[model samples]
Target: MEFHWCKRAQRQQGVAIVEFTLALPLLLLTLLAFGELGRMLYQYNSLLQGSRDAARFVASRAWNATLGKVEVSPDLECMTKYVAVYGAPSTPPCSLTGMPANTTVQVTKLAGTNDHVQVTVSYVFSPLIASGLPAFVGNSVALNFPLVATTVMRAL
Candidate 1:
């Protein structure tokens, strides 16, 4: 019995290209998906760090034990600069880009603990990408990711 393998092999000549052509988009999509995930994590961490910094700042403020609260700025303007300018939440040239629109910095006590300060920084981080689709971060899907970070520390 003679097996004719030539015909089978000849028929598969363009199989590799066909496979690649079909898989290219999937492969690219996966790679881009991972990249976007990383970027999202970075953005979230940045916002988290900003909140932590703000928490520490609020915690360090002079706490009036008698009043049961820290003497903090009523407006909490330092929140934006804290995320943008790093350790220098004070002084000239504060960064405004760090904080997105509707950014809120709420400082509240930990119930029984009058000395504890909790700083919550919330911002709807509409990613630089208009969409969450792969390869093209901005595709047809509109994703408005909400990133919120909160830090609680004892008054120091």
Candidate 2:
């Protein structure tokens, strides 16, 4: 009779909610972590694209000595507006608000060499829900992540 009962228990061995319950948090955490990482990467890519576009735009324009070698100075005020296509000041939770203060666009012209433009974008990121694994010192606080993008094009 005991052997019969043991055999019956073996038939039901795979039905338990405890296993799933234990795994639920981990699964959710993985999802959130992936989501946050994806968001950060997307933003970073956008900044890079913006930098590239800006560089291309500046390099293609005919250098005007009256204005400057690179016409980027007057366009400085419109940098964010210009970078809109690349997701600057657009993405949620990481909008233009995310841009670091005192950001600058540096342009360098090399005689007979490719002109270089550097755009430095910085943002603060915080851990997403159920994903506190990336916290600094395990503290739930916002941390700044600098995103730098550079592009070079043949001088016109």
Candidate 3:
């Protein structure tokens, strides 16, 4: 009886290996897809928070000095750089991770409301899309996606 059971197990020895071989590629691709999606979300969320902070900071400050009227304040640039780097004396988190990190900060006032400020933070994503994912994400957008976040709030 023991010898019969051993022979039966030997007959099925290759089954698990075969199954794993067939499933490995799909599993790896799925993990890679999830990794890409998570990275995009993280970049977007961080940029959004940075823009909001900068916009709020600028809103509380005085206006810039133009020839006769007031232009945008120079402090906006300082604040923007500060927020982009994730605050003073600290480098950008993405930079430390070897991620593509070109952050551009834009500040504007609402077209109708002078007391409202709009802040736009844009980042260039890295690691261009894999050819295999183009069908799902659109062929034209397969390259690195541009991540942008904008925030609007009433000024003080």
Candidate 4:
């Protein structure tokens, strides 16, 4: 009986190794997915904060009390874009050190009874792995997506 039990255990000795091998790829893929998700969220948050900061900067400076509207000049527009992208109104060549290349910022001033300033920041998010993968579902679906953050504040 003891000899038979030892033979059965020996046959199963390599089962755990096989199982781990089978699960390794899935585990790695899951970890990659989670890391990508975290990166996306962090980028989105940065964009949102940038948009909000740009909006505030414009609203504080662009308001025209006499005209009853925001007055964003071409220079101000340029500065606002800089603020959104570089967190400052610095002159070029502004270092976009860690930012995505496709990032864009648009500033719009709405003329109405209650004028508002709108700042929009958009960035293209490309996953580390999925960005290079061919779309299996045709052209309708893309692995890369755009993340946009918009902030609207009353001109003051």
C-alpha lDDT values of all predictions: 0.66, 0.55, 0.66, 0.85
Q: Which regions in candidate 3 have their CA more than 4 angstroms from the true location? A: 1-12, 63-71, 89-101, 128-141
TM-score of each: 0.72, 0.57, 0.67, 0.86
lDDT of 2 by residue, 61-113 (tens): 53556655544444442443345244333322222334445354455554453
lDDT of candidate model 2 versus the reference = 0.55
* Regions more than 4 Å wrong, model 1: 1-3, 65-68, 75-87, 92-99, 127-141
Give the TM-score comparing model 1 with the true structure, all chains together. 0.72
Ranking by TM-score: 4, 1, 3, 2
Candidate 4 is scored at a TM of: 0.86
Instruction: Give RMSD to native, each candidate.
Output: 4.9, 6.8, 6.7, 3.5
Clashing pairs in 3: none
Q: For candidate 3, what is the lDDT?
A: 0.66
Residue-level lDDT tens digits of model 1 in 20-138: 99999999878876887788788778778877777776677647777867555543445433633354564434335555455665667666775777777777665553444454544
- The residue pairs found clashing in candidate 2 are 89-96
**Winner by lDDT between candidate 4 and candidate 2:** 4
List model 3 lDDT by residue over 1-156, tens digit each.
999999999999999999999999999978888888898888788888787787766666524333322234545545544655464412223123322347766777667755677778888777534633336554644456578888887766
Q: Distance (Å) between predicted and true CA of 93, model 4?
A: 14
The all-Cα superposition gives candidate 1 an RMSD in Å to the true structure of 4.9
Stretch of 10 with least lDDT, candidate 1:
76-85
